[model samples]
Target: MVKYSEVIWMLVLFFLPSQAWAQQKVPILIYHSIDEFQGQGSKELYVTPENFEKQMIYLRDHGFSLLTFEHWQDTSKVKKPIFLTFDDGYKNNMKVYSIFEKLKTDQFRPTATFFVISDFIGRSNRLSKAELKKLADSGMVSVQSHTATHPDLTKITNYKEELEGARDAIKSITGKPVIAVAYPYGSFNSKVMEEAKKYYSFGLSTTPQYYSENGLKNELFLLPRIYIKYSTSISDFEKIVNGG
Candidate 1:
């Protein structure tokens, strides 16, 4: 006959790994600009190239796998999976491509999702059609919709134009299926999500938390992301990616 304490310990050993695996939190990091502060916009929105490279190195060195929305299913299968997302389709985001190229290794392949605002493309400060195509063709970036105009979705009545229209606009450029949308201003509501469902498989928000499954309805549309600010120190980055 086994001791009761030993039996409980055996049960603990049997269940813990699966339980922990089910609860694994995946970091979906949000970034805006990859250049130094020129005192133009919100300074926190910019993460310098040097610091960005260091963050990538930390992820690579620590066995993190960089993924795009295209590989969402692989998050559980890969070791330490994380998503690097750049919003606004800024022209400076090209720097991200260069950093990714420099960081690629046999053990690590860096990739990211650029959420491009449809109407803002080809603007003086935003990415051009040619640049978007180049990044998409390079296989390191997935260009998705940030809406036709960066508006608070909750306040907007033009769901078709903002959601489906933006999706169509981006797909026209990248020639890849536009399957995700990062809510402009990180704004959305039940109506917005219902509209999003007709076009997008995923919807992102600036919820400042790592994503974990909770069996909620439309949870994929409610995906959470944490911001990686210009002021985010290396230690803070490590903690963010490591789910600390």
Candidate 2:
């Protein structure tokens, strides 16, 4: 049974011109922890579990199509579509996965990418190989790399171990092709970009801007993303979607 709101939302999305969101870059919101009680990171990064659910509800009820990292390409003609990404392979990310599982649907399927540290897997706070494989096998979610030890990519002396090791580790665990690498702590440089190219198709950063085809004169490795903190109000979410 379709709800009246769902019907209206779908109508608006299906009828809108694909180019309508051209001026505004599509938002790729980055998250860290999804717990009720705060952890070690900045409080702002810890979007409460309640707020997380509210956000998913808002996105679903308001016509937003949640695209997976691989499926993000399907949103070419639509506006207000967003990519939800999480980094640092926290054990608590399993909690976030549960939230997404509860919200799954055909049209409004929520997609997420977990960028994990290769060395952290099996540790107390990181995901194990089996867990990584499970998430990747879901086909709706992707398990990518942060780095082998979560080092600053730009600061590393040997680029090979820093970048490729993580790529290989994730591939071996998930048996999925690893294409994207999110910069640890959003740190990067030209050297980092060059190193990233050897192993990845996308290198995401912390800059909060919409992704637009028009302004991307640089290589695809320097893809910028929006940091979605607890402080970001629903109005801010609106602006992010509309590319304001």
Candidate 3:
């Protein structure tokens, strides 16, 4: 005979949709310079502060939310969520910080990660240790590791020195746990991930895609990120967050 408990279980299963391995596709956008054409590839990584404001505004007005490293990572064995990150410690990021302070709302609070090079802090055109530390203390920014020398980790001869050294250096300055990493030049390999696990909770890459449970089993290690650019229009920005 069908008991009340058995009947309820059957009804729940019959009505509930399958969510076994399915995960929401979240974009982790990557940006580099927030100034004029200063880096390689004709300033591809650089986006003007004006344009940056527009993009942030676009995310604000739209339903898209800014996610932090802590937010994107899983706590209960779930897949990672959407994230936005910047690399290579540029000075103009302070402008982004100010804009975030003035414009962000509770519903639109912006969360971002900055991957900084340990040795390059306070070198001139880059952010100083004080600036980076302040941002880290703000509790809004997730300051992660970009290695001490910004070398391609996949090609490095010493994984322990490259991976652990950067984590240690950042923790010293920020007084926060450096749990995430962005590969210098967006480079990574299986062996690199193997060694990286010894130090980081997550790592990022420059690949143009989103994270899902069905792919990249180390979803934590090899997360894909969208490249925000100078020429990106509002429509293009919409398309990116909407996964176009």
Best by lDDT: 1
Residues 1-244 of candidate 3 have per-residue lDDT tens digits of 9999999999888767565434577778888877767456657778888888888887777656577777653422433235778898888788768878877787777767899888888889788989988898877688889888888887878877778998998899899999888988889999888888899988888888976656566878888888988888878988887767
**Model 1, 117: alpha-carbon shift in Å?**
0.5
Q: Looking at model 2, report the run of 10 residues with the lowest lDDT sum.
A: 17-26
lDDT for residue 165 in candidate 2, whole number 0-100:
86
Instruction: Output the TM-score of candidate 2.
Output: 0.85
State the TM-score for model 1: 0.95
Once fitted onto the true fold, the runs of candidate 1 whose alpha carbons sit more than 4 angstroms away are 1-22
- In order, candidate lDDTs are 0.94, 0.79, 0.80
lDDT of 3 at 97: 83
After the best TM-score superposition of candidate 2, give how far the Cα of residue 58 lies from its true spot, in angstroms: 1.1
Candidate 2 lDDT by residue in tens digits, 1-244? 9999999999899768664643545678898887755466678867788778878878877888766556656767564677888988877788767877898777677778888988889997778888888888877679988988888877678778868988997899998888889999889888888888888888888876767666554546667788778787877766666566
Candidate 1 per-residue C-alpha lDDT over 38-95 given as tens digits, one digit per residue, 9 for 90 to 100: 9998999999999999999999899999999989999889999999999999999999
**Candidate 3 segments exceeding 4 Å error:** 1-16, 19-22, 38-41, 73-81
**Candidate 3, residue 169: CA error in Å?**
0.8
The candidates, ranked best first by TM-score, are 1, 3, 2
